[model samples]
Target: MYSPIINISALEPLYLPHEMPTCHRIRAKKEGAPAEAVKGRRPTDVTIAQNLRPEVNIWREADYPGASDTTRELLHHWFGRDHSITTADGEVIPFRY
Candidate 1:
């Protein structure tokens, strides 16, 4: 299945750390074929519409103090303006903080 896109802006500010490489993990249920058939496929394999659970992990860099502009730039670089990710079955799922 397609991986979910993360919305950094939607995340709780309290959960975000000032340190670099703040790791974020997200999980979603699979929808489509059986898991046995897709067992050996790569995580990003989009060849077949397989029912698979996809997890997305991202590490964000640290932001400078009082640097709203820099933070916005980082956010854009990490997550696009739309903040919606499409799955293998063409399902769009919004990221939850």
Candidate 2:
């Protein structure tokens, strides 16, 4: 397998750590409800989207100079299956081709 070395020196200086946005949820009250009904209700739990980072590779066909068409096809097929990630909801998300 041919792998290319990446240079991240340029991106290092631009990286910054910050808090991600969060959403506050509120439940609706029923019609003709007493004022005390509102007091009994508490704020809903905060919901945030998960941030997922997956490994990636980029290469040209020329990099694998000795690879045949069959070998390339098999490699591509295997890569898609191997890099898939299962979410908390039990859904498998494949890497974008």
Candidate 3:
């Protein structure tokens, strides 16, 4: 699931501690896609496919300012049914636990 995060007060870098270090990637896309992510051993989703599109390369902007319901649904699922988030429009979103 992928959701757009607005009002990022700070996006600091997270480095591995001396005892624990891991590298990762931030995949941002351009084209719109359904908001669902696989939940088991094999994990992937439409975002991955859309992001892979030639035009949807890794960029620093959202595919759309306010992603469609599909995007929200997918993201909600991927993130877990138990979290809460706020939209840019001040809408409070509470996930199902």
The numbered model that scores best in lDDT is: 3
Backbone clashes per model, in order?
1, 0, 3
Query: Residue-wise lDDT of candidate 3 within 1-97, one digit each (tens)?
Result: 9897542422432342221123333433444432232232232486765456434322213433466779756755654346679999999886543
Model 3 clash pairs are 1-75, 35-74, 36-74
Q: How far does residue 65 in candidate 3 sit from its true spot (Å)?
A: 6.2
Model 1 ranges with Cα > 4 A deviation: 1-63, 66-72, 76-82
Q: What TM value does model 3 have?
A: 0.18
Ranking by lDDT: 3, 1, 2
The list of candidate 2 runs beyond 4 A from truth reads: 1-63, 79-89
- Pairs that clash in candidate 2: none
lDDT of candidate 2 over 4-93, digit per residue (tens)? 544443233222222121322233255333222122223435433112111112243243346798887776676434456899999997
Candidates' TM-scores?
Answer: 0.22, 0.23, 0.18
**Tens digit per residue, CA lDDT, model 1, 1-97:** 9886554543454232322233443333454322222223234456343432221112333333345887868766655444568999999986622
TM match of model 2 to true structure? 0.23
Model 1, residue pairs in steric clash:
2-88
Of candidate 1, the 10-residue stretch with the lowest lDDT total is 52-61
**Position 24, candidate 2: lDDT:** 25
Worst 10 residues of 3 by lDDT: 16-25
Whole-model Cα lDDT of every candidate shown, in order: 0.44, 0.41, 0.45
